[model samples]
Target: MKRGGAQHEESIIGASLVAATLGLSVPAMALEVTPYGAIRVATWWTSSTYYNPAGDPLHDADFTLDLQGDSYVGMRVKEGDFSALAELGAYNPKNRSAGVELRMLFGEWNFGNGKLRVGYAPSPYVYRSEMIYDADGGFNGYASLFDGRYAQIKLSMNNGFYLALMRQENVGLAGIGATNSPTTNAGNGYINTPFNMTSTTYMAGYTDFDTFMPKTVLGYEGKAGIVTYGGGVAGNYYKIRTVAGNVQTGKDEIYSYLGFAHAKIDLAPFEIKVAGHTAQNLGNLMNNAAAAAGSFYSNNPATGKNAYTYGGWGQLGYTLNNKVKMFTGVAYESNEMRGRTSDDRMAAFANLQYAVTKNFNIVPEFAFLNEMRSAAGTKQERIYATGIKWEMKF
Candidate 1:
């Protein structure tokens, strides 16, 4: 029986070798596929006055357990110089029920020293940081200056230069009863300004097809020994359409621009990163609570221009052995609109991450924010959270 089994095994090996030599191997013709996912559980607390002003003032706090942060699944494929990726995650801006959303989907074709890519992907303007415990690092920090994913076509060189053309969309509407209000039957519209100039109302312009255009970006990155640096600039165009009782009256266009720079250094056990940006009509990009794209206005009806803004963030990280890490960072942004109250936002955070296993981690983090000013009045908020995350690959 042992001799018969050995003979059968030899016959199988010989047949496989012959098939491979004849170009008939099924395995060799198959494409490789990989899958990955993560799950996270966190308990979070926030000052009730900050998020719920109408509730009981005596309670003063809100808390909940969430499983939405950093939970996702992705797949990667590569065949020679061509590759593609698709990643999805649970996202809900209103903090209601979690909804599956596309995070990344792109394909690249590499040719020696350069590459071309198309689809929805991360903006090249972000600076990578080691902070892992906070949800706002990339979304609310300096990276927020140009943080949203975009559908674009990009060309990049190995030496760190890149350019992209992206689609732009309108995201703001004029406040109720303003001149630009759709209900107003006027050929020209204006965003109403307070008599005392304490607040400015953002206007929603017309969405005529003729006013739409593509945005452009140009950037470069480089490294020298322990230090790395990069920066980019972008130009955007926006148009506001005048409404006369639901009829198109006239249209006005405005141009806005942004510029940013970032630098990072690695020194033994610690790493530090600093980044900053200045922009006009960038509230859409920054995702701040009190600002939106097209929120900044010149008040002059003829120009109908958007306002400018600026902000920056910095972080320092220390690695304490392979199992533990620590990070601290500060971020601030201010709107440049005149006579606007509480238009500045600021935050600071610190956290400790401990690796419980190769695929599991525990992080404790603290965050604070001062809403320099908001529609709800100035309020200070605090967040304390402990997160447990597990990641795996197949």
Candidate 2:
């Protein structure tokens, strides 16, 4: 559920517009625009992890220590039907240098019935769970950011279903240590399954990925009194062409796909949700490895291949009054890559905004993860961090 993105430039742009529009008129920010974003700064220290190019970033394939993922900033905006976001951050492990991260920069056209009208936006396929939720709605987690936003038109049915067709960002659902070469955006994946059916190039016989291809999604939100509930379904089409006139490989690609379900129940002080998602790329883990002499190779095609992946998260929270709120979540994910690895993760989030105070307030949260990197190889290291945020409407 990664929501952080670009903050410096866009946030500045928003603030400056407000300044220019109402030059010292009244309470200044009072006469400002209805939608705006802000700068978010955070600092922290940690140990373990951190990787690089040559291979096994942690070591030469043999090193054990802790590192830090500190110093980062992000910006987000939600104004009427137009919105965008960004995040500029870095990570260091002493022994290795640092690099730039393209957090996010996507926009949307929100319309009647809660449907995005048009424009490019981050691929919702990256998430398996809701990002933020209340009596309103929620979003999926950030599993693929580098894949970049997709360009597409959206159609929303008043019934609560939405659809978008766009270019694929992550065609290969392989894991971080995948044997097959992966797309830049898919670098270091969450999937543990070693085998994949991602297309490497055209003429070489290409195919589509689960999250990369054009997609159509459907969802609905309704409440049984105080109990809030909603769920969504999505599908991806796999197809591609060859630059060369002729160099045939396979006729059709193994279909890549994803599915999800979620709910929110207010049984008193606690508003709980049980959500689960299962996805399986077109490929075989065991046979693919065997096809390439047991080495990860794109040559090991998913011809008549079948593989699977699944995960879920639970959210627990309490609503205070009609504004302040807090929540905690636990999650589990299992991928079939790298032998077998699974992820056991924990998260805590709280948003306290007072409509009584200009409908703006501070939102802060923390998330911790410990990949059980063992049989089913999950995250062995623990990741913990916190964030503070602000929101305002004119």
lDDT of each: 0.60, 0.42
lDDT of 2 at 196: 45
Per-residue lDDT of 365 in model 1: 72
**Candidate 1 per-residue lDDT over residues 1-394, each given as its tens digit:** 3567557645744553453344332456453445566766656666533445543223356565666445666667666888877776655434433345567889999989999998898677766444443443443543345455778899999999999887553333333113432223232222253121111222343333222556788999999999999999987765555545566555555566789899888986998988888887675333334353233444345433466678788889899999998988887776655444435676677777788777787777776655445423444343433333333323
Instruction: Give TM per candidate.
Output: 0.75, 0.53
By summed lDDT, which 10 consecutive residues of candidate 2 come out lowest? 286-295
Residue 27 in model 1: shift from native, Å? Answer: 3.0
lDDT of 2 by residue, 227-278 (tens): 7666556555443322223453233343545666666677776678777766
Highest TM-score: give the candidate number: 1
Candidate 1, poorest ten consecutive residues by summed lDDT: 194-203
How many residue pairs clash per model?
8, 33
TM-score, prediction 1:
0.75
lDDT of 1 at 304: 39
